[model samples]
Target chain A: MKNNSLPTDVEPAKTDPRIKLITAKIKKENYKPDALIEILHTAQNAYGYLPMNVLKFITKALHLPPSRVYSTVTFYHFFSLKSKGEHTCLVCTGTACYVKGAQLILNEIEKQFSLKPGQVSADNKLGVSVARCIGACGLAPAVVLDEEVHAKVSSEEIVNSINAKIAV
Target chain B: MPKISVTIDDKKLDVDVGKTILEVCKENGIEILTMCHLKGLTDVGACRLCLVEIEGVNKLLSACTTKIAANMIIRTKTEKIKRYQRITSELFFAERNHVCSVCVANGKCDLQKLGYKTEMNHIRYPYLFPECNVDTSHPWYVLDHNRCIMCTRCVRACGEVEGAHNWNVMNRGYQVRIISDFDTPWGESVTCTSCGKCVHACPTGAIWPKAIVQGQLEKKPEIIGELVEKRKMNL
Candidate 1:
């Protein structure tokens, strides 16, 4: 058993191998402007979300204004500044799906979970969002839960599906 | 220029070799409504508003993107085409905060103009006005996430045209938004030149000149096309 094992330093120690590896890579790149996207991608992958210090380090290294880096991240939907849920559900509400009662299916799920689309469930079980079209119009009124797609769904089916997943 | 004949609204016409059906129609005084595909930017083919039926092509092709082929048969203003365009326009209005009366780009906006041309009435679809924020932190421009159509015209203008690469679009599907650098605030983003070209390229009020009065918005005509031509000359 270790006594007084709490870390005194708030920051991760320089001796930590992860930090050293990142620093070595940064040194090798010497921070070109073109590498801004790559660095941000690496930082987000490593740290989950970009912290202020990481952004600052990127700013200095890339010789780019902090605004430029921040804008690129915000402009494209591929990157996330905030930590997202492990599971994301995308429902199709395109014209084809809309005609087939896609809205009702989404409403039913939201009512059952008290979670709006784009909101993570209180238990962090799911994050839901409505997509314009997921290229599955033939499967109209489709509700995609994580990687699985449920088609021709009723309100009851949505509720049961959620309950079943939750029970599991 | 080589000549190619095509039909528009069932009227046959001979057009230049390499021009799109849209360009042919425009030259012959035909009106086709669009929002996303600007003359200057590389055709994105996202809107699907410009879709027309070609005799041989089974799938509807974007008039703006598809170049004219010799003796190509085409049909415009068909019931199918009208329905598709109307639905797409309705979706555009429903997805964003396009409350025209209060919007800065009310009269002058391309989306509004498209709505006018299409005679879009009563969005049959439900609204998805996601709770987006307004960033006035940028000294010269206001970035309203609600009004953005996600056309990426502004993004293209910033990166490809202005060569700033300050703006980008974040997320997939409905959660997507135009992000300045690193998903930070507009003022905080480093790549923004504050050139205001993005504001010009935006078809809606998503990116607008700061405090543009109710009756004061006017779109610059042919600026993007002119700029593209100028750039091509330089290249």
Candidate 2:
């Protein structure tokens, strides 16, 4: 396909075994037009993020409009259009977490790995993002790695955990 | 269809069935404030300016999309409704960089009139100050994302009325944007007809002709309904 300079990242997504799994999922849904949301979830699972090519492929495969697919991905916070590294790190920036020095943790992680909010590290080992009040106000400053939430996290603890993931 | 009696601001009237509260309000000479409720387009209930308090319903419902129920005791103007209207208008202003003083729509903007009707002297919320784009790729018009309120009127106008399907929304709350043709420049659109329907569809100065400048914009959104009405005539 001829490239049209899409807004997403330049690095093309790899054609791995995940495409077959995604195809099977789409087939399982019988290509229902209303199954867009569920198909998008499957696409995200197949690709770490909903890359532009993956979105286009799904649009054609399911016979859905491109705008419908694009708008849905953009409307939901959980769906990402950009690449997320192998390991994801999220810092709670909710009012409660901010007062508890969540900024320090974000800053420390950024400085240590040279990562910014919503960016996958060049090494593709870690990605940094911020959350607003993850409902862990009691924990004050909380950090989420992959799926587990760490409460009352300090600057040093965040740096070490990221390093531990990076080391892997 | 059955006609039912309803009271709007203490005035008793018999309204037809299947019509929305907004349509009935308009028919009865009652004024209801609106921004995203353009004619000839499907209502997505994007703007909350026309929220009316019903006697039975606990929550304020949007008048544009909600069908009038039988015996509906509708209140278009109340102390609480006015307060919410003022706040919603203020939030619309503060959500983006709406520099009315230097805008192309200037005094001719609907958003400005909404502010005046709500008596909004100042916005209580802090300005979002999002870094929006100015897409002047089209030869005639420009899409200024800064002044956009995400009402989706342009998106509907182009797709539903114009049959272009060029303008599409991208992203979620607060960070959402109206993109033209796969998020590319508008000038490069493969589907746009350059009809300027989206320009007329916009409530603010978000979409306008490049031939005009500040305070020079003149739009007639009412023409959308007129066009739809004329098409139905088949004369």
Candidate 3:
């Protein structure tokens, strides 16, 4: 006889170690709904981006509606629903950076890689994004490549750096 | 409830203290324009159409959210307020694809009526023709993001009245959107009860039933307030 019923012993806690970290954080916060943003920060760090299954698990643990959790997650800029690729290039486009040559850098990168802001490459190797400012006005026209900030960069320099990172 | 004396547009009136300026204005037959405010739902003051000039305050305040205080001198009809209202109406038109000629809520839309009320003849700002999606996933309803002004009335009506938190706003700034269950299709939503409260709550043609075509959509937003009042009587 075919066993139509699924196995009851399979648990996400045993398969994924990241779920344990989230569970520990939830417990540390006493499952309080006010701690949702803090818990989401931890979950985003673990998964790189928030997945649907993880959101459902968090919603269930917190006893909140799915829409409430989803709304909070999408309201903030720090959280992301999709993967930001393995390597990221964040260009500053604030008033200071825009006064410098930030747009030129963006144009050069688009010409070289054919990837616009908020777009990932075909192979998922690099993602390009633009931020209003990183509060580094002194370093105008700055580009953050994989968490490392390059200050006062020209279009050619940014292109070279992105090429080096993508090549790796 | 205690009464407070307030002068609105040079008219003296003694009204209830806890009520908002909009409420007091409505009771006194003073015209104050509003779009995001539905009587039953909690006032978010999202739309800036109901701004009124209060004495001693440099900045204009929204009438819907600002409660009436003792001896508060308010001016609902002013040259400055009219200019701001016109600018707001223009911005609303420029922000989205509000082409009323082919819209479902053409003559009946609140935004169109607001434009006429504010004397908005032309839009000064450049139109941002951003690509928007029309989600027809729900069996009975459709959510067209093109005509949305981000008033959030539907979001509040779904959560507060229907008790089904299926609709929510996602993202921020120009990219903000109303999502159904984790940004999935509405038909695939697990939380939505499909009570159609949002359809009636929407002031624009952004949300409508599937059966209705353009220019035939009718909404009864008063039903939300009536339902809330009925619930209070039962309790």
Writing each residue's lDDT as its tens digit, candidate 3 over A1-168 gives 111321232335635879989999999999999999999999989877776678888988998778789889889878887777788999999999999989999999999999899998888788999999989999998999988999999999989988888888
CA deviation > 4 Å runs, candidate 1: A1-16, A19-168, B233-235
Cα error of candidate 1 at position B227, Å: 2.3
Q: How is the predicted docking of candidate 3 categorized under the CAPRI scheme?
A: acceptable
Candidate 2's C-alpha runs over 4 A off are A1-16, A89-119, A129-168, B214-216, B230-235
- Candidate 1 is graded, for docking, as incorrect
lDDT of 1 by residue, A1-168 (tens): 011322232555567575565566677677568877777777766654555556666676677755466656655555655544555667789999999998888888788887787787766666677889888888888888757998877778877877777666
- Better structure of 2 and 3 per DockQ: 3
B128 in model 1: Cα distance from truth in Å? Answer: 1.4
RMSD of 3: 5.7
lDDT, each prediction: 0.76, 0.85, 0.89
Q: Which residue ranges in model 3 land beyond 4 Å of their true spot?
A: A1-14, A89-168, B214-216
Q: Is candidate 1 or candidate 3 better by TM-score?
A: 3
What TM-score would candidate 2 get against the native? 0.82
Native contacts conserved, per model: 0.37, 0.34, 0.61
